[model samples]
Target: MRILVTGASGWIGSASVTELIAAGHQVVGLVRSDAGAAKVAALGAEFLHGSLEDLPALHAAAREVDGVVHLGYVHDFSRMDDAARIDRAAIETFGDALAGRGGPLLIASGTLGLARGRVGSELDQPDPAVHPRVANAAHALALAQRGVRSIVVRFAPTVHGAGGDHGFVAMLAHIARQRGVSGYLGDGANRWPAVHRLDCAALVRLAIERAAPGAVLHAVAEEGVATRDIAHAIGDALGLQTVAVAPEHAAEHFGWLAAFYGADAPASSAVTRESLGWTPRQPTLLADIAAGHYPGD
Candidate 1:
């Protein structure tokens, strides 16, 4: 299959290119800059020049490829609404192009906010009103009815691995370095699910290859790791003290991350593993942290 992968120069997107190419698939990666194009070329993927905001570019790429793996997302938290608008438009363009073609459209989503205080599974539905991206995910799943095999893979918040990861764990490590202490919210009991970068890339490959239409998959390896344990890991790596911040002081201590640091967003991947036979064969979050990939600069 000739796959068009958006965010192909990104962290997980780059890994997915390697995984797909190893499985004998041709990849055309969407890149927004010369640097991104060069990175894609180094990975042996053909490059398509465009940003996610370019609906026409998205449509053209979708029409030209056998499948699409939508992994690109704007990370601007302050402009989430704008990012979501672009994502929805891009998804719609791809759906329109693949409507009657039976082509696979595997999109990246998140396990957070799907359910609160419990382990979220593929069975749970995200409230569209909660976030625009959540609504966009549902829109992609509905494309199944339009003759497209659309699959949504919900990724854990902390997709950890070797260096180059700038996700939650890395953020925490950086904060710890700046503050001289690794802190978690309240008693630090809230949980967060995690998966290695390589494992996530593997799941993306499996979904595009075999997932049924409207299938929702979780790319979680550890269902839940206590936030305190995570803090301890960071503390150990940076030789800093691990402390708990009161809920009232969380914002001051952790900055913008306080909003998510206290969330108990554990997720289950049992169904994904059973359905796709995806066994994660990579280091766990703590192991990866201990290996020093997240040592704060």
Candidate 2:
């Protein structure tokens, strides 16, 4: 199989490309810049130079590939509308190219804001009115009606690793260092789900290779690591105190992280594991943090 992976130079996408290539599949990595192109080429993938808005290029690339792993998204948190528009356009473009062709299209979605206070399962449909990304995933799933084999892989927020993880965990450490106290919302009872990067990559491979059309997969390894526990871990790493901050002051105290750090986002991947025989072998979230992955120097 020749897989077209958008965001192939990114953290998860890069790891996915490596896994796919190791499994004997040729990879076409979509890159928008010279640096991105070089990065993909170094990983032994052919590069298609274009952004998600470049539908003509994306369509052409999609037409040539055996499968697609749509992993690219504009991560402009302050401008979510832009991200939504780009994501919807990318999905539409990919769907148009692959419709009636029955090639697999794996779309990336997230586990956050799925279920309010409960654990989200693979079967829990996204609230149509809420997160814009949910609708984007729905659009990809609808492609199955047009004969495209589309699967949605909703990722846990924190994809932690020992090397080069600049995501939530790293941001938390930065915040703790700046504030001098690691803080959590209210009683600090809110939980956040997490997965190791390699484990996430392996699950993506399984979805690409064997997932059913319109299948919804949750890439959650450690379903929920408590917010207080996370604060404690960060404090331990930074030699600071883990304290509780009121929910109203989360944004003021934690900066941009307040919205996410306050979410109780436990998710389950049991069905994914049973369906694909994929068990996560990576270190637990706290273990990864404790292993000096989120260093405070």
Q: Which candidate number would show the highest TM-score if scored against the true structure?
A: 1
lDDT of 1 by residue, 97-174 (tens): 999899999998999987876778999987888888999999999999999999999999999989699888889999
- Please report, in order, the local distance difference test score of every candidate based on alpha carbons: 0.93, 0.90
Q: Which stretches of candidate 1 lie over 4 Å from their true place?
A: none
Worst 10 residues of 2 by lDDT: 288-297
Report the number of the highest-lDDT candidate: 1
Measured against the true structure, the TM-scores of the candidates, in listed sequence, are 0.98, 0.96
Per-candidate clashes come to: 0, 0
| lDDT by residue (tens digit), candidate 2, 2-35 | 9999989998999999899988899999998999
The alpha-carbon lDDT assigned to residue 30 of candidate 2 equals 92
Error of 1 at 138 (Å): 0.6
